[model samples]
Target: MSLLESWDRGEHTAETLRGTTATYATYRKGSGPGVVVIHEIPGLTPDVIAFGEEVVAAGFTVVMPHLFGRPEAGLSPLAVAGAMRQVCVSREFTKLATGETSPVAGWLRSLARELHTELGGPGVGALGMCFTGGFALAMMVDESVAAPVLCQPSVPFVPGRRRGADLNLSPADLGVVRERAAAGCQVLGLQYAGDPLTGTRFDTLAGEIGDAFLRVDLPGRRHSTVTTHRQQEAVDRVLAFFTERLS
Candidate 1:
């Protein structure tokens, strides 16, 4: 069955956030801690929602943030791609969305704080993907972040351009996250074997963060499949990692 079919059958709860009013599907099963699942470039599509459900089944309250917000809400991958193209084509909108004020990392921090206090009140884990993968590490500056999983994080897409690139985290911000790692919070990362945008470069960065970094190398896997096809394995690993750390 298609992922959306399962989603519509009441397998998971379709809900909207109070502040953003952006719709997201949530799955709550286990009871120890909370986790926030960040969506990819295509937003919160079916597979990503399914991964969240799988994590809930593994014993945690999972919150999947609706990153694209209301405008292209509930869109499919193709639709999101088209919308994103338009957003990128307009340089002003792209800068506005990726700028420091509306940064992807800041929004994730908001969700983490809410999950820590309002939703579960028992600490939280973060899972970020593709363009959002680095967010989990960035969130560690806040102590509430207990565990983080980055699956083929696609920001910092090119080499050499990383230092001053839009998607690249500044050296100062990286330093703060490094401090968090030094304090012993674990950060996990995943990337496909051959994907250029997130391959060795991400590995190098993960190494710099030191012993708290756990890198998952998926052989013969590409970026999209890591989310779409092999999701069960991905979700299983994520839940296991979170359970080990958060519980």
Candidate 2:
């Protein structure tokens, strides 16, 4: 069996879930307070879905928003890689399909509200990874986001061959989110040992963000290992973090 299969069968239960597909294919599963999950560079693959389910098993509704609502819905990593290129290279394309005015982020906020209402009013928890790591923070800018877990968040230092360059939140937006954090919201981050992309930047962000930031470093773990390779530990840490912060 694959690694994801093992994690699912042992740690999490699978359930069919749905969310608004207005601009993108959003999906959700499990129960209790909601948890919004954003995908990595490869889009909404089985790995991402499994991660959502893991959170769901921890007693939170998990929502995985399909940012790339096109044909690249977790078929091949290569295809999603191409889509990543398009996101950076073709601004007009992204603007046309998703809009320049923070389309996906807006959609996420709407979904968070949906969870708040659907699950009876406790604001949703958001967990973003790799390409969508900063998405948790972006979701917070709107105020409905109470708890955010960024597992190896990517895209902040998007200059070169970074881990998650697809995340493109503006600095001004960051400032607004930081202001929210100062007002008492909590943002949690988890990363591995040697991921150059998430480690250095994660530290810098934790330092700059101050009390609102909760950083968890897996000493010998790598980038993907945080959630992919080290499945049980990651899920445990995620559940604890969300429970402590969200519950």
Candidate 3:
């Protein structure tokens, strides 16, 4: 189905989550364990919302926060450029900084905590794509985040080899994430092998998280795994991952 068709079928409630640093407008739906769906650079567009609906249909409560861009805006080159500009200049996001977590990740952790506390599950799940992809891994610093999925995590912009190997996580945060992985917290990452935006960070993930990092590398340069590129196998794998980790 088209993204618009799937979006229309989703019955999501609009709500606001107040974080210490930012207040996020969010779309929420479904029941059971909570899964925070962080949008790509172009904001919560139709494709992103459709992906959220898929998560809801999978038996988990899905909360999609509007980190940037207009909610329900359909994909367009102009819209994407506009959102990309905003993300590039936004103080909340550390766009070109290596080994540093975006400031927004803390707010996301708060949202996840609240969701898991209210939803009453063993832990919460998180899925982030594109610019927001590494945010899921950053949230893993907290024990409440059980299932963290990263799709084409492109951040710290990959200007050089050092940044390419960086996970967009601060040294302290990276330590916590490593510890969590060592404790058996699994992380799932998806990307196209030829996508430059993803850089060599998946290799970094493999090295840092060891066997706990599950890599879903598709062939070619497709950037968006669950949305723009629309890989059915990746989607199935994510659903299965969430079911295994959160259910």
Clashes of each: 2, 0, 0
- The TM-score obtained by model 1 is 0.74
After superposition, the stretches of candidate 1 with alpha carbons farther than 4 Å from their true spots are: 1-32, 69-77, 86-102, 119-122, 159-167, 231-233
**Where is the poorest 10-residue window by lDDT in model 2?**
8-17
Which of the numbered candidates is closest to the native, going by highest lDDT?
A: 3
How do the candidates rank by TM-score, highest first?
3, 1, 2
Clashing pairs in 1: 30-59, 130-154
lDDT of 1 by residue, 6-122 (tens): 332212222221233222344334355888777776676666766666777777877665555232244466667765775366321223222231244554665677678865543
lDDT of 3 by residue, 1-247 (tens): 5443432222222222223346667777788889999999678887888888888898988888877787777788888888888887877888888878888888888788888888776799999998889999999987889999999998988778888778999899999999999999999999999999888999999998889999999999878999989999999999999999987
Q: What is the lDDT of residue 60 in candidate 3?
A: 87
Q: Quick one: ranking by lDDT, best first?
A: 3, 2, 1
lDDT of 1: 0.61
Name the runs in model 2 displaced over 4 angstroms.
1-22, 69-77, 89-103, 156-168
For candidate 2, report its TM-score: 0.74
- Of models 2 and 3, which has the larger lDDT? 3
Report lDDT (CA) for all predictions: 0.61, 0.63, 0.85
User: Model 2: per-residue lDDT, tens digit, 132-151?
Assistant: 67667678876777888777
lDDT of 3: 0.85
